[model samples]
Target: MVEYALMLAIIVGIGWLIYNQTQLSDKINSVFNNAGNLMNDAASKSAKPPTT
Candidate 1:
């Protein structure tokens, strides 16, 4: 009985961790995408002809 209780606790803990990580992963992806967009914008501006 105790072993079953312990197993349940561990499973719940792992599931919670996975849920948190999924949320965190999405945030990380958005941040990386924003950084990539900023880099692309900078490159586009730099590639333009120099002003007089």
Candidate 2:
């Protein structure tokens, strides 16, 4: 009985950890995508030919 309880607790803890990690990964991906877009925009603007 105690073993069953311990197993349940461990499973719950692992699930929570997985959930948290997935959320964190999503946030990191969003930040990276935004940074990439900003960098691309800056590069394109700098590459434009300057008019007199």
- Per-model clash counts, in order, read 0, 0
Residues 1-52 of candidate 2 have per-residue lDDT tens digits of 9999999999999988987978977888999999999999999999999989
Global lDDT of each model? 0.95, 0.95
Q: Tell me the lDDT of model 2 at 24.
A: 78
Kindly report the root-mean-square deviation of model 1 from the true structure over all alpha carbons: 6.2
Q: Using Cα atoms with residue i matched to residue i, what is each candidate's TM-score against the true structure?
A: 0.58, 0.58
Which residue pairs does candidate 2 place in steric collision?
none
TM for candidate 1 is 0.58
Total backbone clashes of candidate 1, pairs 3 or more residues apart or in separate chains = 0
Worst 10-residue lDDT window for candidate 2 reads 19-28
What digit string (tens of lDDT, one per residue) describes model 1 on residues 1-52?
9999999999999988987978977888999999999999999999999999
Q: Which sections of candidate 1 miss by over 4 Å?
A: 1-22
